[model samples]
Target: MIFFDRVSKVYPDGSVALQNVTLTIEPKEFVSIVGQSGAGKTTLLKMLLAEEIPTDGQVFFESSDVHDLGKNEMNELRRKIGMVFQDYRLISGKTVYENIAFTMEAAGKTDEEIEQDVPHVLELVDLSSKIWNFPKELSGGEKQRVAIARALVNQPDVLVADEPTGNLDPVNTYDIVQILKRINDIGTTVILTTHNKGIIDSLGKRVIVMEKGKIIRDDKQGKYFI
Candidate 1:
């Protein structure tokens, strides 16, 4: 389970990024968070990853307080979470296979494991045929698929996608959303932050709406309502 207990973040400049926000995300659940820009969506994800420290309260993953972990402990904790972003952060110089393999290598997986798992994830993203292609050679949607494959190669417990389909066309956006749904169906917890109303309405999953750094609404089966 992931829990944010009355968390608040105030930057050094005294800007409030989050204020008294409390949320709970159960395991294997698919949750969507929607709000306008600066509504604290990114800040909330950063807090969970320990990229941003909260001014008050705590963020917990399962039973561990995320901010209280040691260096090695934090690294272990981070391995349980995978992140996908709006920009497909693929390495320009690496092939699709290499991009995914790099993540496994960093996690200390052996060469044999990398060879086996890389193709499996690429297959999951339907990009096996493009394994040798570089990021420059793939289309935007394909690149995002590769990004998703890289994020999932390690099989993290939670997958956080922040505006994942922001740059795609309508057809591509629908494909990306379907891919996200398939990932959730496989029992990986998914936390998605998006502005696409069509995607949100089609999901019919738990939706949490935020504004001014506070949760304004939470619905069991929700649409995109600001």
Candidate 2:
């Protein structure tokens, strides 16, 4: 389980990004976090990855405090989480296969493992036919699929998608949402941060509403209400 024990974050300029926020995410649960810009959604995720230090309290993954981990321990912890972003951060020069393989290689997977797992993840995202295509040759949705495939190649325990469909058309957005649902159904915990009300309403999962860095509401099987 992931826990934020009264976590708060204040920047160097004394701007409060998060204020006394506490949250818990259980394994295999799909949760969506909705808020306007600067509502502290991204800051919350950063704390999970230890990219930002909390001003008070602690963030814990399982039993270990995320902020107190040593370098190697932190690296191991991060290996179990995958991240997707609004802009599909793919290498322009590399083929889809290479892009996914790069992640496995970094984790010290064997060549045989990369060869085996890359195609599996691509198939999961329905991008098997575009394995050799470069990012420039694909559509926006396909690029994001590639990004998702890259993120999942390692089979992370948690998938964090931040505005993944922000750049896609309605059709592409639906496709991506379906893919996310499928990923969740397969048992990986999904934590999504998005402004698309339609997506949020369609999900009908747990909704976490945040305002001014404080969680205002949390509902099981909730809709999009700001």
Candidate 3:
């Protein structure tokens, strides 16, 4: 339930991040975006998150104009979307449980709710035993799993994962992909941007290929071909 209409983004120093890019992501769909660096994938995700304003067009999330929203309204819109990054942005001092609980607390979830949901989500990511572990105490895969759990704690309608497997080994990468697929099967829309061709090929999902700020190919059940 997202739409981009003739969207373009031009930075102040004359760099174009996106040009006439138009795309739509339906509810409960798993879509993968693939391209080299500077292909505007990050800009597209930022536009959806309302972190970047389009230079010449509009972005809509389920019929609401994302760029037109006020500050409070934008925050409300963002609550419906969750983001996971490559770096595993977890708090160094917080334990696995606390990291997720912190996100729930910010979302106004009560202590009881956090207690119940945190363990459930950790179980979903297969990180139940690591509840008391700190970020530095975990492996890269465990850290990424914690990040995924944190992102899912709020149960957002869409999950945007940007290069989530970039830092992990192959086995960990495969595990993360399977976890994402499981999330999608449960009805959350997933938008993934990755450079790994084998991952894209194994996914066998809708693929969008971008080059120099434009979508050059969009294929259903697509491969990793550039």
Candidate 4:
């Protein structure tokens, strides 16, 4: 579903984040990228989501080269892609219900549709009871769950999470992973970047390791080999 051909990203100051990294992720598959900081993991995800243009090589979504898209076209592509960040980028002032609801509303979903869809997705993330709480009132895990619900409310075809479980305790981390797995089961392609050893060990899926801005290893049923 996603392809990178000889992708390399170098910052303006001559620092390399990704070096000629080539990889592919099939539809409905869960691919985890394991790497230490400065290994270009985020550079890979950002390129896929059009947040950054690769300094060299190409990034393709399905059949189209993303770098060739216009601003108008990229917006359409973003709607099909969902991103979860290490920080729960929630609007602290908004209630959990409004947090998820506003996403569909912003996309021009009707009031009725928002009301119907919001509750359904909240249940999916097991946040039904916490729907009325504000970000400050909820626990770390609860806040992250709210973020996940918001990401899925758009019914995105691909889910890209960058260090999603970084701030949570083990119990919360486990919960978040389970929710991600459930979403993946429903056929959304999942691309995750994490430094957590246990998750990479247990998942046993495809692992792409990047070092000094280059893909050094690519393996199926991959391990956390640095």
Model 2 misses residue 190 by how many Å? 0.3
Looking at model 3, how many pairs of residues clash? 0
Candidate 2 global lDDT: 0.93
Q: How many backbone clashes does candidate 2 have?
A: 0
For model 2, the superposed segments whose C-alpha errors exceed 4 Å read none
Off by over 4 Å in 3: none
- Which of candidates 2 and 4 is the stronger one according to lDDT? 2
The TM-score of predicted model 2 comes to 0.97
Better of 1 and 4 by lDDT: 1
Checking candidate 2 for backbone clashes, the offending pairs are none
In candidate 2, what are the lDDT values of residues 1-226, reduced to their tens digit?
Answer: 9999999999899999999999999999999999999999999999999999999989999999999999999988888998888998998989999999988987889999999999999999999999999999999999999999988989999999988998999999999999999989999999999999999999999999999999999999999999
Answer with 2 or 4, whichever has the higher TM-score.
Answer: 2
Q: Which stretches of candidate 4 lie over 4 Å from their true place?
A: none
lDDT of 4 by residue, 68-159 (tens): 99988888788788889999899988999988887887677999999899999999988899989899999888888998999899999999
Residues 28-143 of candidate 3: C-alpha lDDT, one tens digit per residue = 99999999998999889999998888888999999899988898888778778988989999999999999999989878899999989999999999999999999999999999
| Count: clashes, candidate 1 | 0
Pairs of colliding residues, candidate 3: none
| Each prediction's RMSD to truth | 1.0, 1.1, 0.9, 1.2
For all candidates in order, the CA lDDT equals: 0.94, 0.93, 0.94, 0.89
TM-score against truth, every candidate = 0.97, 0.97, 0.97, 0.96
TM-score of 1: 0.97
Q: How good is model 3 by TM-score? A: 0.97
